[model samples]
Target chain A: MTGAGNSALLSIRHLRKEYRPGQPVLKDISLDIDARGLTAIIGPSGTGKSTLIRCINRLVDPTAGEMLFEGRDLAKLAGAELRAARRRIGMVFQEYNLVERLSVIENVLTGRLGYVPAWRAFLRKFPAADVARAFDLIDAVGLDESFATRRADKLSGGQRQRVGIARALMQAPALILADEPTSSLDPKTSVEIMELMAKMGAERGVPIIVNIHNVELARRYASRIIGMTGGEVVYDGPPEGLADAHLKHIYGGEEFL
Target chain B: MNAAAREWTRFTPGERIARAMLYIVTAIAVVWSIRTIDIIPEFLYDAPEQTADLFRRMWPFDWAFYPKAVHSALIETFHIATLGTILAIVLALPLSFLAARNFTSNPILNLIAQFIFVSSRSVNSLIWALLFVAIFGPGALSGVLSIAFRSIGFVGKLFGEALEEAQQGPIEALTAAGAPRSMLLVKGYWPQVEPAFWSVALLRWDINIRESAVLGLVGAGGIGVALDAALNNLYWDQVGLILAVIFCVVVVTEIVTSTIRSRII
Candidate 1:
């Protein structure tokens, strides 16, 4: 829950996610994400960093928690309510996760799926406004205009991540959650992606909660850093404030970190 | 990579003797089985004269029978295959959902579906035709049931496997997008499975056309009746003519199916 002031756009309280009994993947983790900036969640493998971000959208159901987004408790929501909450929060994935067979533009339009009726979505009949916005998003993402007609599978990895960003942008979301969105890219490409993400988040004043492994990149781009270890929130602060001691604690060793 | 192990080794005396004895026994068994089955030859001894006798007796085909023979029988054959395929595709689509591990995941449901499909597929179309002939009694209905039963099993098994390996990314995205369960099947699942479905369905259509032709042996109506009748009367020429027609039918069906399938993909 947010503090008495409730300044955050999304609030988490006592969150726990357990895939099996007595084997908690996320244990009693909680944080508040205020609107208007980028927040990076940094953690090593198996720390439930991805699970925390996915939980707000209920992608991976939390075993127990209070996740409040926009005045509604997401953890308590179900069915339509959960979907409606999710629509406001866009997500990008490590693999880009664009429907490979679909065109880049079509994938962008998929962000509008929450707004469109099921029939419209089923028939690929997005509203004209949605289509126009999709084209605009395609243009905004630095893709060639004609590339909108190309299938996602044909794009290079960097281009696909660009499309992934565009698809998230298409949602016009107040909040964005990215799960290791750069892990698949080259180091150079990963920075370019981080730059794009930061630029987009800054331009829209949308708080993006990103789960990333690249601590240096996260330090460079993120306004706030959230480090998790062993399913617990270990360190939550500004990037410069997180020390080598914390990195060792979060990753559990110097070599891996 | 070992030199000694990789070298070509000669057989030991005992091994050679065992091999000789095994070969002798196999040859004897094969000959006995063939003789018991009446496939071994008095005809081999009189091969030249017997061939001549058969070909001569297999006379000028009764071409007058062609016009009457094709009337209801051939049309009904196509109808049976068409309707059977249609019904099987319809039935198999849902059964595939139950059978797909990603979709149902219920072990009991999956196992039951497998049992149903396997049992249906285990019997040959002729056996199905024979069984249905007993029930539906010597008509196109028997042929339809036979084809439908066999196709249901085949289409279900193949399509279920396709559903398993289909790109999980889209499915994951769809669920994350908050698509309903029914929406998952119709919108997300169907699109992914469409290409596999169309290609296989067309291939099955080709096979079913040939299966329909053979179903007539058990009085499930088609070219098989004519073929069977021609053989019963010692009309080898007419039997040969029927085989030629069947060959033509199969070739044309294959061409048509492939052309349509190419367009679909």
Candidate 2:
């Protein structure tokens, strides 16, 4: 695979996003992600980490960018092409954005919505294999079968995040992007969630890219760490190379370090 | 500068003058309206006596008329309200999605949906009943059409607002998963707005029931036709019985809707 020269699963180049004119959130971001292990992106609030992740799935359109994922230019894809590309990328949210009124099983099944016919989804008549896979995924994400029938709103923060993971994995995605998946969880739950994600990524052999606020958690769980500051990546290395000097540079303060 | 010596008034001098002027204008307007409205002094003086005499004639209602006309008319009224509400729901559901800015994101479509709602709401049900009666002829069909048309605005506007108010988080997640627009609507938006949809439907149904009860006044059909006939014939006893029945049905519908709304919400 390395002999092909361009072996990156996702290659982002000159990705720029600005919500308002002249006030860019992501400034000329360029990176290549290989197809394995967990990569954690650590940055302070409002540093464009979430925006960066969102741009990959085209949830937040980039002002200007080139994101080559699989074989398509993600930035140029529109309509059906955009949707087809999105189905390959699983996304976990900070809020565990499961449909609050839907049952857990339904939420997981929604991960297969891109593949299922619209009418079947409307009638809640997902294929039997997809249903079985969803059930297995629910169990794999650390939730028992009992959780499948419960409403998502009834789950605690931790449990909800687990469902979120299962929902993402249900897509059988080529890549997984988690945008602060552990931020809403308690400290212990945060660790567990991160561990679960890392384990899941390894098991499925899918590269996981996570945007995280906690530096320690990133260092602990990430195979590769990319530190960003002011919409620019300041440090890109293994966890051991992320020293206090790099931390000060990335966060723009020495006292916090 | 003593803090205690500082003075404060609810309104400034300009505001006080403005308020005083408003009151004077309101008083003058009321007086003008009262003077403009033609009220005969003799009728005004005998109002209490006329009311008492009418009440005296209305008592011991013609209960014998219950099975003959009022019962079937009452049932027809209920049917008009229920069917009208169901039809309105069916017609307004798609329009509501279009009207919701978050859902459609097209200004022109939103404007068209909103325009339909406003036109539907601008005319009262009675006025709509008149129009429909002209088109469909005086019957329950006219009443149903009037109720459905009038209610589309109310149900569409409120349910559109509910759709707009739905959390964008789950929708974003669904979008990221590459779900098609229809899937997002059915799986994402529908679940969030389902309760509000039912609540709005029930509320509109309740109001439609009351409105349909009076469509017969315009020859559009229902219990109102029987009530109108009794009033035209000067059968005060039958009128009293019809009014009493309407009151009981309205009260019962109110209770039923509130109970269902509470459970759904």
Candidate 3:
């Protein structure tokens, strides 16, 4: 296990989250994420996988924890400070979560909302460089130039996920968090998405923390794998070390295996 | 139980008894209310004769009255509705944000906004006209103010509901992208609700036109004053002309509005 050394990009200590007063979803958890490469968190449904990623971004507030990122405690920030922290962290969702009524280019430009002024965003007058970069990122994610002007609702599931990836990359973020980014796609598209994510992470040198349900995809794409159950990390090692016993421990059944 | 032998057509004993009781209660209430209101079936016998007589008196409409009394008043009615709807939209824009659960989040502000919508909607537009007439005195000012106040509740209520029913997925995405509240409102929410907002605005304008036409009955201004005068003086021909102009205006407005709506949405 990586300790809270100088090389760690983010260091979390004894993190805990509870929606209700007493019933905690994430128990006291601790981990250190490096600065580059893909790390996959695999677990069953309703096991606090989404909650853990949301907590890192402060989308779900931590009941008790210390999340140190860029020399500040993320769990303790509020208002502008919290927003500033969030700007550096890009998030992708299980659903594409694109603004359906907005054009593809406009959705991509929304990633710069934190840096741009409100009036500019309202008028859609992003800076020239931002616009140029948006087009570039759209291309980077395998979308053609014509797709930029189309409404998001008109795209296929795979195409929308490609847009989702472009939108997240537009932020120029320090870290990326993907909550089931490929769950809605077919097997072929899912593999393509995972490959694109892996390639993007490698080229950009930004670490990606992905919460996924498919163990095979995680093994194929991730450098490291963290197996979780009941809000606790049951297994943490290289993806090759994740075997049938670890899967049994994480899923609590051998019928499917 | 066999796969196909069980009964599927009959209600249980409790359900049958409850349904029978409901029918009996409804029947009793209807009879009691009818008796209490003291409606006489005999009075309806003369309705057709009275309607025919009124129609006969109103024939040969006074076309000359249009340029003098009806035209300017008709224009004033249009002005009242347009200005009133614009003002209501301006006021309702923020009020709806306050009323929406996803937007406001504070219970107290939500309650206040909802209370304002309910109270404004509870009063009839004529009652609002009456109140404004007392306060602002007669003429187009009172009519405009009355229409604005009456429409605020309708526009605000529907706009708030639209905001509430908007897809949460994009909002979550925006929040995750570190958008400010204002940005969330404009980029995240505004695009989703734009069509609904325009539709409501057009529908309210249509309603206000019809409403403003009647405002002059209480001296609040518009063509209603001409209508009241024609009725009082027993100039049935002028009244017929005024009604015809109003009908034409309303039908044209509806056609124009529906066309715009279809094109935009």
Question: How high is each candidate's TM-score?
Answer: 0.86, 0.95, 0.96
**Cα lDDT of model 3 by residue, B79-125, tens digit:** 99999999999998999999999999999999999999988889888
Q: Write the per-residue lDDT of candidate 1 for residues B205-252, one digit (tens) a residue.
A: 789988998898889887787777877887787776677677887899
As for DockQ, the candidate ahead, 2 or 3, is 2
After TM-score superposition, the amount by which residue A239's alpha carbon in candidate 2 deviates from its true location, in angstroms, is 0.5
Taking the tens digit of each residue's C-alpha lDDT, what string does model 2 give over B89-160?
999999999999999999999999999999999999999999999998999999999999999999999999
RMSD to native, candidate 1 = 4.6
User: Which residue pairs collide in model 3, if any?
Assistant: none
For every candidate, C-alpha RMSD to the true structure in Å: 4.6, 2.3, 2.3
> What does the lDDT read for residue B174 in candidate 2?
91
lDDT for B40 (candidate 1): 52
Tell me the deviation in Å of residue B84 in model 3: 0.7
Give the TM-score of candidate 3 (chain A).
0.97
Q: Which window of ten consecutive residues has the lowest lDDT sum in model 3 chain A?
A: A1-10
